[model samples]
Target: MATKDDVSQSARGLLKKVKQRYMKSADFNGLHISTIWNSREDLEAAAELVTARLVEVVGPSDYMNIHIRPWPTRRKVADQIRELRELSDDDYGVCLYPRAKALKRTKLPKKCEDAPFAKAMARGRSTLELAFFSADVLESYRNDARFRFGMGDFGINFWLSDEAFDGHQPEKDHVGLMHLGFAYDMRQYDPEVPNTPIVRRVAAFYGDLDDLTPEHQQRWASFQVGDDGIDPHPVWYASQMGHWPDGLGPFARLKPGAQSYQRLV
Candidate 1:
């Protein structure tokens, strides 16, 4: 059996490797650790060992971890929209697209008029869907079996460190570090497994804003959101806007006859 000191040493080595690899790779800020190691067990074991130290350095509320499973079919997205429509309040969601132009027209395209996800982006309309529903709704879904392996497709975390620490903090004053979680990468889009659940935890180390390079600044900003922003599908209108939410009203009128998930491959 591995001694406790051996395990800690191994975990420290893994953390150092990931932190270095994460900085060197483009867009690796929020990429899942599993993608780097190709093993969920390794990611979990590493997280278990270092998470306590991270908590000591980073505050609990400053970090986030989540499992995001994309809805595979258009029908599934439509069903979710129908249920969301029943919600009376729209505070959790805000419209972020077409910010350049105001809604000059109130009508949506005929082909997408009836689509549940379609929303008229006229003035004062909130179209993006926020994952704000009750937990019971997820529990009631029949496709719950897919949640096991399918949900954790991306798993990662992020941390901040200055040149003084060289991306590794001292034993003391490490409480603010917490586990930052998963994100979606459009390049990994698998048509056969469109709904594959992603499990990601992200941790990054950065110096003060003044010390960061321009590229580092951009990478730092991108991970603040939960997505990598590389999808090309029209159905991914919202994801293109940075894992925000899909906006179909504009796409429908602009690109008629286009179907959801049509260009995913």
Candidate 2:
């Protein structure tokens, strides 16, 4: 089990870099999705829609764990990782690719309890990573049954796991360290290839920032509003990419080609 001790000087540098990028992104809504509460019916319906779509992407399985954005208590997602795939070495800590630009470090923010992402921040032994993989590989493997439902090898989590802890935190016990962000690698995909699975894009926040005297107006980051008592059994996020309802409006223009599991597939 990796821990704080495992965090090397180099690793800390990268973690800091990763957080900075996320902080900037949290404030960005242009290509971002925000969490919205769902009615019991809406929640169930959304889950059904999300699950149906996921099944088409990776197929079905019994041990699968799902996280709805902003729902809290996420799965730790270690077993979901496979050996680093096709991505290049330079892609490791660069959270935003052609989409978002990362900011350079200036003065560090004072650690504060109220700051978003304070608890779930990566510290100690955990280092961030990015990966790439194919859908055919996941479908062919038995252990990969749950992966289709999880942030996959090729996704942006390949950019950096949306959530990561220094130690081995299993999916069920995921608390305190709530890393988020799971997007599709829109840049790479092949409709004709079975093995060319869609790469899952991923990134996360390390709730470790502290700005005792925050600016009255705006800040660099914003997270799902709520207390620490978020439920992890199922986490929720807002997305218009696939066939899920996230209260379309500004996000409606996303045009994931209309909802439907088969269409998403």
Candidate 3:
């Protein structure tokens, strides 16, 4: 039985193959492939190779573009804190202003204070960053008559929510929707690479992704899945920094089950 992660991996692999076939057939029409992941290191490593291949195949000219949109750390912290406050009466507070002020005053490492979103928000400016593409893709698929007609046999259902910070804070429950992107792009590429069987196969796989609909794909893509479960904040933070909490120094356990419930035999 393939897990959702397994399915996602398979889907990505098929998409890569389809893209390759399409490039070969269409004289490389400046196809751009961008991927978002939970780890900057992993994303960078993957992008290096993919970018090289794209350059090799398309010869620049926007023929290949690969970007790794790691989760923004400072923005995530702000979002998490805001969410925590919204959920419960707990003083789930992070000293955003103090942290920024300290960094500025001391001229220490600017990493914490230098975050664009953090800096902007720290100044008491109203800000909203929308991950619209992810939403737009799903909407396009859902509303487009041509796409819907073509995908008649296929059905895609998608839902988006902030689940990464869930259960972590006593407040509002989950972080706001900061990280957003679409997982369904089969239709977008299908017509462009109709001649390529690989493209067709990839489209078919996604077309038949019944167990996991487009909504499920979107949710899973947004949240980070781990041994503990879905944790968006950790995933987003780790993605931005390219390291997990374990990589950081000693911190309280983010997950449970470490303590022995009973003495093992």
Model 2 whole-model lDDT (C-alpha atoms): 0.26
Error of 1 at 110 (Å): 51
What are the clashing pairs of model 3?
30-63, 38-239, 87-171, 87-172, 88-171, 157-215, 158-215, 164-232
Q: Please list the C-alpha lDDT of all candidates, in the order they appear.
A: 0.29, 0.26, 0.27
TM-score of each: 0.21, 0.22, 0.16
Model 1 lDDT per residue over 107-175, tens place: 333322332222221121221211111112222222422222112112222233344245464433222
Model 1 is weakest, by summed lDDT over 10 consecutive residues, at: 93-102
Which portions of model 2 miss their true places by more than 4 Å? 24-83, 88-241, 244-265
Q: Give the TM-score of candidate 2.
A: 0.22
Number of backbone collisions per candidate: 39, 35, 8
Residue-wise C-alpha lDDT for candidate 3, range 1-265, written one tens digit per residue: 2221333353344334433332232121222322221233323322332322221111112112212111122333333333323332232211111112212223222321323332222222112221212333344434533221122111223322234334253332221222232123233344566553211111111111212333434443343212221112333334433453333222212324433322221
Model 1 residue 127 CA deviation (Å) reads 22
Give candidate 1 regions above 4 Å deviation.
1-7, 29-45, 53-265
Residue 133 in model 1: lDDT: 17
For the record, the alpha-carbon RMSD of candidate 1 to the native fold, in angstroms, is 25.7
- Relative to the unseen true structure, what is the C-alpha lDDT of residue 220 in candidate 1, on a scale of 0 to 100? 39
Ranking by lDDT: 1, 3, 2
